[model samples]
Target: MIRLAIAISVVIAVPAWADIAEPSGFRGEPYTAPVPSTLQGAKVIDAEMALTLWAEDAGFVDVYPRTLKPQGLPEGTIWQEPRHDTIPGAIWLWNTGYESLTAEEMQRLEDGLASMTRGNPDMPLVIFCRADCWMSWNAAKRAVDLGYRKVMWFPGGIDEWQDALGPDLVRAEPVAP
Candidate 1:
């Protein structure tokens, strides 16, 4: 009886100790964690390869989320919006990389992608965020799902680009949807 009771207790406790299952869809929070080496439909590239693509005028999309002003600050608190710096010509598609997307967010992503590709699904599109961040992975995966013919994922992102190419970046704002 004691053994059976212990087994029951353990079975109940196991769930609490179990790790969260990786979603078959989009990845959720803790977006800064390490990601898989490959994104099934996209070509995963390193800094050198990304540099080559950049030189060739491949469209780049930065998926780093913008920091919005915090709400509920004590009255008269100064809130400065944070500036974002990205690849010289990359379009910033803010907040589209999150796991959950509202209708507006989805439209923003689609519109930004269209603007980047200029209505040519066959155009080479490179997607990225910071190194080891899953936002880039999700964004790259989304590009593939959106039927982009040529999707290259720079998993190393802006940091790697700067490290390899002498720190060239430009301040960017999110493209209007």
Candidate 2:
């Protein structure tokens, strides 16, 4: 009787410890075609696809984290192309990735994007960051929310870019250093 009672208690206690939450809300959803999987309504693509699109004159954009409070970025923490050569016409938009951004900041980013694109909404814009980074995800979402329909997210980011394109393709060093 005691043994059964102890077993029951152990089983009851085990559930509390066993409840482990997933990180970054990663759902492991299978990749589907036609519409590109997204983090938050933003179209996401792989590095290979982005490269192909860029080669075809599709406008690509990089949404990166900012070290500075606003506008300016800290030294050594800016986004760069794998070959130090961006996708010809790619633009860099620094969005610090703070938990919350002010309305003014959002407007600034929108205005910058508008100016960069020359008011062309049809221009293709690709957003990227290191793999598994939620920063890019959030940035992409914000872009979509702002009515930028041509935005694309590069999920593989720098790591996959280097692995597939070789060392010569990697121009930007890791920021953690």
Candidate 3:
């Protein structure tokens, strides 16, 4: 649980760069066509397809940046509840500096992903987070480039899943480091 808390805190705290929950580090990727049409081997799927793959224990990655608190609240303002959820069994993948992962971080990401998929390179890995969010797009692309072979990107994100599976059906996991 300590690890989880640290992850949440990191996601919430904004760096010296961008404002709001919008990822400050990397914003280089395009938001349109959240899913790439020509990903070579990776497949872009919808919420429904994501569920289908989950039944087979496919890996699910949540690249959404978590928002813990709003900035500059009034002196007596009460904080509103924050909503940052992932699909069932989704792992919170952090978004760092323009998706330009370091060699160590890249290895760690690849290793975590492999562990999630039980070290099976051919296993399907489903990734999602927010609608039109480049974080997820870049992560999905990176996963494919890592030779995962069965990388899947769900473009609609948490909102998409909530819309399709009803709001309550969606699940949440603490953002990971």
Predictions in order: lDDT:
0.86, 0.56, 0.67
Model 1 Cα displacement at 103 (Å)?
Answer: 1.1
Identify the candidate with maximal lDDT.
1
Q: After superposition, how far is residue 110 of candidate 1 from its true place, in Å?
A: 0.2
lDDT by residue for model 1 (28-68), tens: 88998767777788898999988888889999999999888
State TM-scores per candidate.
0.83, 0.57, 0.65
Candidate 3, residue 65: CA error in Å? Answer: 2.4
Best by TM-score: 1
Kindly report which residue stretches of model 1 are placed more than 4 angstroms away from their true locations once superposed: 1-23
lDDT of 2 by residue, 109-135 (tens): 677567656788667767766666555
Q: After superposition, how far is residue 145 of candidate 1 from its true place, in Å?
A: 0.8
The alpha-carbon deviation from the true structure for residue 38 of candidate 2, after best TM-score superposition, in angstroms, is: 2.6
Q: Model 3 over residues 72-172: C-alpha lDDT tens digits?
A: 88799887656555677777665421367767556656766877888888888887767766667677777876788888888777788778873354446
Q: What pairs collide in candidate 3?
A: 26-98
lDDT value for model 3 = 0.67
lDDT of 2: 0.56
Higher-lDDT candidate of 2 and 3: 3
